[model samples]
Target: MSFIHLDRPDCPEAHRPEAHHPDRKLTARKLITRTGSSPPVHCGHVAMVTRVTKNMSAKAKQSNKSADKNANDRNDVASKESDAEKANPQWKLISHEQINTLLDLTVEQVQFQFEEILGLKNYQTCLKEASLLDYFVSGFWWTREMNYTCQQISFIMALLQFLLDNISEKQMPFVDNLNEFAKMISGTRQSPSPEVDSLFDAEQAMSITDYLKCSLFQNYQLYEFLFSQPREELLLGKKVRLPASLCPYVC
Candidate 1:
């Protein structure tokens, strides 16, 4: 029977260490690799394999911990930014009806006092576009009779949206915000400091805006005069009678 050759091919005979001391009766069959060396030096020393493996494992764990720390830091920054935003918001969570109940008759509403008008733009989705257009055309302005096209309605609607959204306790956006509104409608600019996104990004807003720019934004002033409704003014008349002098005060 032929004997099986078990010597490693990489450990050549010339590189094999000769056994000089009798303490190590090493031969080619007894090959041991030296620690911390490449090319697998054939020697008679035990390699410190366990120590090297432990060091590499420790380095890997440290890298993992550093990555986790960086992730936590990013998450903390995001959370703080969100909290800051929550602490200071530009617009409050209030409805149009609630605002209407608190407002006084505005100068814009004065025109309505002299006409049988019904051209108020409602923010609620309950009113169909057809009905809204009908109100605009028939609200004593005779928009259809004056040859006002569909684009005119679009311009009127954009103005109403800007007015309603930017309205404050004792302020409205008329001539003061006219330029800003025009820029917004033409898709050229956004609100200066709004909490919301560009208005044209909303449903039907972009189409209407395009039509407004293409057709009827030129007659913005005339349309404002014809179909504008006055807001109700809030007035309180209180009469107080003082004692001992029969004096009365009205405020």
Candidate 2:
């Protein structure tokens, strides 16, 4: 007798369920059936998993965009700061005490020349007629104009000598500060030439006066501040006598 064996390896092929196709889409029903779980529970879990995956991808993209924006903002801020720093350079200013000290030193240095001018034969007449104060403030004598006498020229040259002797890199911390202060006071558009060592050399004859003229003509702001603008303390109690007209401005 030929009896059919359902549990044997030789069981009929038509009786076994078909194998799942590799390319077939996996659905909630298929998953639940494969796992031997309830359809409702597995379908809900699958939907939640899909939603969670989409949310995570969106969050990652949002985080990346936020990071990019933050980086750009920082770069922008840094660039602006750099531009601001470049636009406005840092400058140091001389103190009031330093100015006072410089004035005193200058007067002390030029005392001999001042006396020499006063000793001139026509000193009184020149002081009355010529703008002696203006000449001193200008620190230069235009021989062509012949407005100032030899005495006035000598005095201005002496003051220029004092300035050349005193204002040195060794004497002052920042020489450019003094130069910049001069520029601000003069309201001049041109800047002075860079301070030169040869101009300050003691061996150079009349180089000090030349340097002073160059500086003043290039930027008269400093000259105005030092001499034209009156300061009570500048020559107070000093034997230096200014013209009656200038006494109000200087005394």
Candidate 3:
């Protein structure tokens, strides 16, 4: 009996067994010889790549959020510090012992004098006025000693001249009393007797250098002693007012 050789290499196409289905037909040789991947494996690889890309995108978004939040936090802190500075204008220096010695008084005595000069019923008000005076006087001394520009020196000198003019015109009791107290402490004239007209005339053509020679600038220690206290202590209970004429220069 003759038997059919199905697995022979020279098998005829017409006589060979047909594949199970056209779409599903595949052989080990065909799979190995193909240059591209199979559908199932390709889909799985694409899905893995997509998942990795999504994870990277998520991480990037999270990093951006963290950066934004940190920026906001820094800005908030800066804003708060700025607000605090504005709300409370304080003296830059605080050498209590030096100030006491300069004034020839104890801390307690300085406080008392401040209260008396400002006519402050509350202790806190005295401290605030003292700090303000310190800031003003220190600014003046620094500007003078550091050789500030002529324009800058002139502006400050003009402001001071304005304040002095106002004090004389208003006859502010606090300034008069403070001047007297300063004179007593220094054993030198703090200012010309209040009766002696104007120390500086806005209309005058005097130089800033000439203005500095006046008693106000000469007796700077009086002001430094006034502002030695803490700023918060100064504004605890009262409102301080700048002279109306000086308001334009302040802002």
Candidate 4:
């Protein structure tokens, strides 16, 4: 790098002897007599010029190598950051339709089930349950006239579960409108406040919902494990496990 800097100011036309004619003549005159008809080349001066050329070439090569290395390092850092962003992102709510493919339960229908069949007290408790799978299993039938696919039923259960965990203060009555519920799940409507927003980050939300959606479409045994036994029996496990699921809501 310094050689290039020096060449810009000191050796503008390095290879051309004519470009440095003034210096060449001074060197030649010093080595050869002023009156000499035939002047021999100054061997010592020639050797010095050759050495300077070689040194400049080497310096240029080293500078280029360092520049290439820096470029590669920058590219590697950019690639790693992109991968990290994909792995974990910010979370947003989604629509119920995105998650459910079965019977379209109106918000009125869901509310009716909550108020009439399950009643207000149990409805509130059910919404606050540890596992939505358990709450749905214990509550009123979602299907009566229309044949409800198990997949649709499971999505409804999972949606309810998400609401229980993330329902904002303003959206408490949002279940009254199916359209609103759809918007809530898809993250279209701005949540009333930060408090009601999804608790999980983008990556975690994606993982949990992906599993719940898969279980909705397929037959799964883990539903029982997720929320099956009676509350008393479920709480009978070891002390370490007892505080894992319901403790957040209870405490």
User: If ranked by TM-score, best first, what sequence of candidates would result?
Assistant: 3, 2, 4, 1
- TM-score of every model versus the real structure: 0.24, 0.27, 0.29, 0.26
**lDDT rank, highest first?**
3, 4, 2, 1
Question: For residues 163-247, could you state the per-residue lDDT of candidate 1 as single tens digits?
Answer: 4344332244455555655554554124223453432334445554454443335544434433343533222345655675555
For residues 1-251, write the lDDT of model 4, one tens digit per residue. 35443245366665456444656564456445655655755899889999999999999999999999899989877765454323222123223352243234655555444344323444333432334423443321433232333433343444555444333333333224334434434441233334444323355335445544444323223343433344523442454655567878865
Tens-place lDDT digits, model 3, residues 223-251? 44344444545344566798999999985
lDDT winner between candidates 1 and 4: 4
Clashing pairs in 2: 185-221, 186-221
For model 2, the stretches where C-alpha displacement exceeds 4 angstroms are 1-41, 92-251
What's the count of clashing pairs in each model shown? 8, 2, 2, 7
- Give the top-scoring candidate (lDDT): 3
Model 3: how far residue 170 lies from native, Å: 16
Q: Which regions of candidate 4 are displaced past 4 Å? A: 1-41, 90-251
